[model samples]
Target: MPRPLENLRVVDFTHALAGPYATNVLAQLGAEVIKVESPHGDLFRAYGDDRELAKLGMGIPFVGSNAGKKSVSLDLKKEEAREIVRKLIAESDIVVENMRPGTIKRLGFSYEVCKELRPDIIYCSISGYGQEGPMRDYPAIDNVVQATSGMMMVSGSEEDPPIRVGVPAADTYTATMAALAILAATTQRARFGTGQFIDVAMMDASLIFMYGSTAQYAATGAEHKRTGNMGFSGQPTSGLFRCSDGHLVSLGVVQHNQWVTFCKAAKREDLLEDPRFNTIYDRIDNAPALVEIIEQLFLTKTGEEWERQLSLGGVPCGMIRTVSEAMELEQVKQRNLRVPLNIPGMPNADLGVLGTGFLFAEDGPAVDGPPPFLSENGEEILSMLGYSNQQIADFLASGILQPSKKPETAK
Candidate 1:
């Protein structure tokens, strides 16, 4: 099967998580992404827990997101480098950047300049706020965006202090949203025969993940109170419960029939007939009493037993698992969501790295190669742009073009 974006070329000027991850998605979809890096490389190259990997500038975090791309390091301040980039953009289909607003313009490769180079170039700029906001120039990361977007407020229990999510929710979601918007723009280009300029803001994309509570607040003028582990339904039966084994089991018994089934499955049909717990409202009113009864019932069975019984009995239930436990699940392994990558310098054994969040039936998402070393393909990329061997060497010697230096670990 033919890959979807196999014929497309992308000039990626993104550095950190959101921008890089966004173009990484396009790369997995088969775009030939040429990652434009500065001399020192992306800051994320020094991020992650592995000391050796960090030393090599192939930190786990960077490795996870940057597979399937060629790297070209250039000092944009130099006219020679800017000329090379202009040549690249002229031959590319898409251009993406995550710099502060107006920064790219100062670097001489703004949307106007790129559009001049390639009339139908789809240019996307991912920023903290957007191109035209008061806070547009403000710096933002995952936690900061979470705090500003009101996402942190709705994450923890009402009594607890606001808690940013453990993962880089803002970066991850924003990247996904940007990739989606880029694909949508491609579709639009197909119809209109003109490229589009996409502006994606981390704050705006963060709110999309909170659409449920955001819409509710908009419709009713009521703020959402954080309910901790409770399901969105707010049903007494739909929350995390401790099982006999001291493990937590989430029960999603929202529908009336599911509640009835839950009660029957637990051998506590008395809950069904209890006046204080008969209806959804009644249960809400007597939540403490209902929760106490359910808690005691759940404590009588191990998490596995409860999962098996409740799930087989048509009640939505599952044991809460740690990341390692979740990854070890047979179902997860069968799904092949994570792909094994042969990262150079790690070891002979294949290293497992994350792929696209979704799958395609025909030519599914896949990486063409491992995450690049800094300017790993600079010489080759320059050659492709019609630069001769002498010109490339001269540029490299003059510090206009930085060449790749494989880490000592790889040697």
Candidate 2:
């Protein structure tokens, strides 16, 4: 089948999550993504290992953003390597890099140079604070960005300390958003003969996630706080309640009629006539008593029992499942959320490699082959550039060409 963007070429200079994540999405969409790395490889190859698990390049994090792409190793510090990158840009449709603001420019591959070579090129720069900002040079990570943007302040319980999210939510999300912008730019260029640069800031993305709170704070100086299991503004019938099986279930259908319907469905008809909980604001004023009412009624039924009941009655509610439970969910698994791909080149050669985390139209890309051994494609790539075996040997001997060194985990 002919895939979208199948003819497009992308040069990826990003490392870790932010840059590689964006490039990974492009690769899944059928772009020819060339993942350029240093000789030592992306730092992510070594991430997430502790004393016991530290046998080799675990490559867990690296695998997430590097699937469905070809890798090439080049040291940009060398002028010869810089020329290689420039030549690559001249042939590529898009370039994605996540370096400090001036790093690429110093390497002589600035946006202007890139556009000069390919006027219709879409160039995206992912950074901590964005270019042209006061703190553009400052360092950033997910936790610090969340704290600076007051995201953690609004997560978890109000009484508990600010907590970072369990996942790389900010980095991964920002990567998606940046990729969206790059695609948009590409579309605009194709349609109108124009291309431009895109700058994405993780902090800015975090702030956008909490725009409503930031707007309210700007207008009235009120801070949004952490409310454990309770909806903001203390709305009744909009929180987690305990089920008979000792599981937590959330109910977020806040419409007044839904409240009435929920009470009937839960067999708590007496609450309809109760004066203290008659109106929305009235219930808000008496949240504690109303919560106590819902909690007691909810505990009468098991989690699955209440789920079916609420779903049938059109009341938004469900269980507070852990990651394992969610992965094993019937509907989720049926949707192929956790589709398995075999580790390429492992002893079990019958299994193929898994490409990307997402699917398009139906299933994600069928990897078609195992993850290539490091430098497995080096000879082929050089030959494609019209280099003979003798020249290729010279480049390799001069350290101008690097075949891949399999990370420890590859063995």
Candidate 3:
């Protein structure tokens, strides 16, 4: 099967989550992605609390987003290393970097430089703010961007301290959007024979995720309040409820039909005739009383039983599940959400990571191979650029290609 981006080559100069995630998407779609790292490798390789893995320079976070790409360590601070990168960019279709604004330019591979090398190169820059903004140079990570973008304010209850999302939503979404932009640019290049620069800001992407709330605030001139586990529609039945087993179930009875179905399923058909609960708006207005009654009824059954009955009765509901439980779900297996990776030097040969979000009928997204060790393909990449074995050795000796010091057991 011929993948969509099979012919494309990408020079990836990204670290941490956001930039790597975008390149990962490209790699999954069959682009030949060469990930350029510094002599110390990507800082993400030291992220997380697993000290043992961090020592080996392969943190879980790094492995999660870096699969299916070749790694080549080069000290961009050196002129010789910069020359190597220029050569790599000249031969590639796209270049993606997530450094702070002006960092890549200082290293001498800005959009203008790349365009001079490759006439139709797609250069993407991912940053905290943007290239030309007041906060362009500010250092930001997922949590900081989440707070600055009003995401934390809307995440938890109003009484709770501003809670950051458990997952790096800002970084992940920004990466996804970057991939989309890059793909769009690729299409444009094909059509017009020209390349362009893409500036994707994590702050902008975070705001996109909050578009619904933003729209509401714009129209009503009132701020949207934090309502934990409650649907934004203010539906009385669309929230979490505790069952007899003390476990919780999320019920999403947003539509009138679902509300009526829920009422019948819980043997509370009298709710349909009650004036305060007659219409969706009426139910919203009397949500407190309605929720109290529903909670009492829900406490009569276990969460699993309520899930079974409500789901069968056409009401949208599911039992709250832990991360482990969710991963082990039958649906997850059926959808092929988890994929096996055989990373070199890792203790586990068959490590599981997430698969692409969606599938294609032909030539779909797939993890071509495991994540590379730091500079794992340094020699191979240099050779592809027409360097002789002696030249490759000299480059390695000059600290231009810093390969990983693999454990004896891995060798």
Candidate 4:
């Protein structure tokens, strides 16, 4: 069985979370991704707090997103090094860069330059704002984008300060969007025999992730309200509640029948006849009283017990578990969301990484190899591009290329 992107080559000039994550998805889908790094390395290679890992440029953050790819370090300031990039792009199917807008152009590998090298290339540029906008020149990272995209504003309660999401939501979502755009461009090129230049802005992608809220505001001129620990459905029945076992359970009793079913599950069906809590409108109007009664009812059982009871009784609900706890579940193990990952010089470590979200029936997404050390595959890549051994050695000797720095200690 062959993976979807098998034999396709990508010239990756991206680094950090968003760009590398996009290429990581392509690598999982079986593309031969050639990660072009500076003579130093990607900034993210030293991003994590682990001293040993960062020393070897194999930080957890870097390894998490860079598996199944080849690495080649070249200082593009040198004309010879830039020529090498041109040659690689000439033979590659796609080119991806996440440098601040115009930075790649200054390096002379803009889409126009890439088009001359490979006319049908799919060039994707991921940036903080966009290729051409008032704020295009401004730099941005996940936190900055989150704050600027109105995401933080909708996260916390009215009394609380805006809360930044725990994870890099903007970067994560933008990566997925970039991957989708690249694949769409690939399909379009196959049909029309033309290339595409895709510009993905983190701010734009962040807003798109909150499309429903934005759309509602656009349509009704009503701003979204932040309801802490409460579900977006706006029903009093749908929210988080603490149970007797000191665990929290999230309930999804949005519909009228679900509310009724929940009351029945708790053997409190008398609430259905209560005028103040009978209809959805009445429940909304009398939310304080209704929530107080429901909270007391949930306190009678453990979170797990309530989950099983409500779920079996046709109400959507689940216990809120920590990430580690959730990972321990049988369902998580069976889903194959997490795959074994082995990085160079870390053979004894028990490492696992996530693949793409979706799976195929056969030849599905998978990591073909471990994450590369800096310039780990430079010689091989150069050879594949028709460079002789002597030429590769010369490039290495002249500081045009940086050799990989594999860790000496195996653990």
Provide the TM-score for each candidate, comma-separated.
0.96, 0.90, 0.96, 0.97
Q: Candidate 2 local accuracy as lDDT?
A: 0.75
* Local error of candidate 1 at residue 72 (angstroms): 0.5
- Badly placed stretches (over 4 Å) of model 2 are 49-58, 218-221, 347-376, 406-411
Tens digits of per-residue lDDT for model 1, 351-387: 6777786878779888787889999899999999999
lDDT of 4 by residue, 1-411 (tens): 888889899999999999999999999999999999998899988878776777778888998999889999998889999998889999999999999999999999999999999999999999999999899999999999999999998876778898999999999999999999999998899899999999999998998999867888889999888877777778988888999999999988888988888888878989999999878899999999999998898899999999898889888999998899998899888888888876645733568888797878888999887788899889899999999999999999998988876656542
Report the lDDT tens digits of candidate 3 across residue range 248-269: 9999999998888988987889
Clashes of 1: 0
In model 4, where do residues sit more than 4 Å from their true spots? 408-411
Lowest-scoring 10 consecutive residues by lDDT in candidate 3?
A: 343-352
- Pick by lDDT: which candidate is best? 4
Cα lDDT computed for each candidate against the true fold: 0.90, 0.75, 0.89, 0.90
Counting only residues 3 or more apart in sequence or on different chains, how many pairs clash (N, Cα, C under 3 Å) in candidate 2? 1
Each prediction's total of clashing residue pairs, residues at least 3 apart in sequence or on different chains, is 0, 1, 0, 0
